[model samples]
Target: MIFEFLLLVAIILAIAAVEVKDMLYAVLILGGLDLVVAVLFYLMAAPDIAITQIVVTAVFGTFIYVVAVNRTGRKEVIE
Candidate 1:
């Protein structure tokens, strides 16, 4: 049940990342989604993958995205 709930949360986060207007918010949502996925991986008996996911995706990826957003601005410029 908990795993299923995490999956649902991940799905919701993904959708939110897509729907959100702010690039920063989307990056944060993706970080959350990655965390949830890491939990799911841990629950599935893949501790290594889970740790990698948290370290690589949740941490570094978010940092990179945040930096990019900061440089590029939060909102998309429609041409």
Candidate 2:
């Protein structure tokens, strides 16, 4: 039950992330999604993979994305 809920929340966060116009907010949301995935991995008995995912996606991935967005200017292209 809890696992399903977490996944649902992650899915909702993913949608919210995509729907959000602000790049920074989207990046943050993705970080949350990555965190949920890490928890899921840990629950699945993959501690090593969970740790790797946390370091790679939850941490560095969001940082790199924010850096890139900051370098490029965070502007929503409304066409």
Candidate 3:
């Protein structure tokens, strides 16, 4: 039950993150949603995939956000 709820929430958040116009908020939410999916994967006994997701979300996702922020300039705000 809890896993199902988390999965649902993760999916919803992922969608919301993608649809959001604000780039920073979208990137943050995308990272969070990826982490949530990793947790769900752990709960489902897919430790390998879960670990991969965790690492990717923690490392690559942050890298992407940093690159994006650098390219866009920190002062610019997306509506």
Candidate 4:
């Protein structure tokens, strides 16, 4: 039950992240989706993988996206 819910929520978040127009909102949503996946991994008894995903993708990946967005300005830069 819980696993199915988590999986569904993660899928929804992934879709939302992709559909959103703002890069910062999209990055935050992606980070949230990553956390949901990490929880799913933990529930599947893969603690190491979950931790790595949390640290590597959820944290660092989000940070990198935020930095990139900041450097380029929050809105899309069109020439």
Each candidate's clash count: 0, 0, 0, 0
Candidate 4 or 1, higher TM-score: 1
Candidate whose TM-score is highest: 2
- TM-score for all models, in order of appearance: 0.93, 0.94, 0.78, 0.91
RMSD (Å) of each candidate, 1 decimal: 1.0, 0.9, 2.9, 1.6
Worst 10 residues of 1 by lDDT: 70-79
Taking the tens digit of each residue's C-alpha lDDT, what string does model 4 give over 12-46? Answer: 99899878878899999999999999999999999
lDDT for model 1: 0.94
Model 4: weakest 10-residue lDDT segment is 70-79
lDDT of model 3, residue 58 = 64
Per the 3 Å backbone cut-off, how many clashing residue pairs does candidate 2 have?
A: 0
In angstroms, the error of model 4 at 50 is: 0.6
Q: Which ranges in model 2 have alpha carbons more than 4 Å from their true place?
A: none
Could you give candidate 3's per-residue lDDT for residues 13-55 as a string of tens digits?
9789778877777778888888888898899899999999999
Ordered by TM-score, highest first, the candidates read 2, 1, 4, 3
In model 4, where do residues sit more than 4 Å from their true spots?
A: 76-79
Q: Best lDDT goes to which candidate? A: 1
Tell how far residue 61 is off in model 1, in angstroms. Answer: 0.4
1 against 2, candidate with superior TM-score = 2
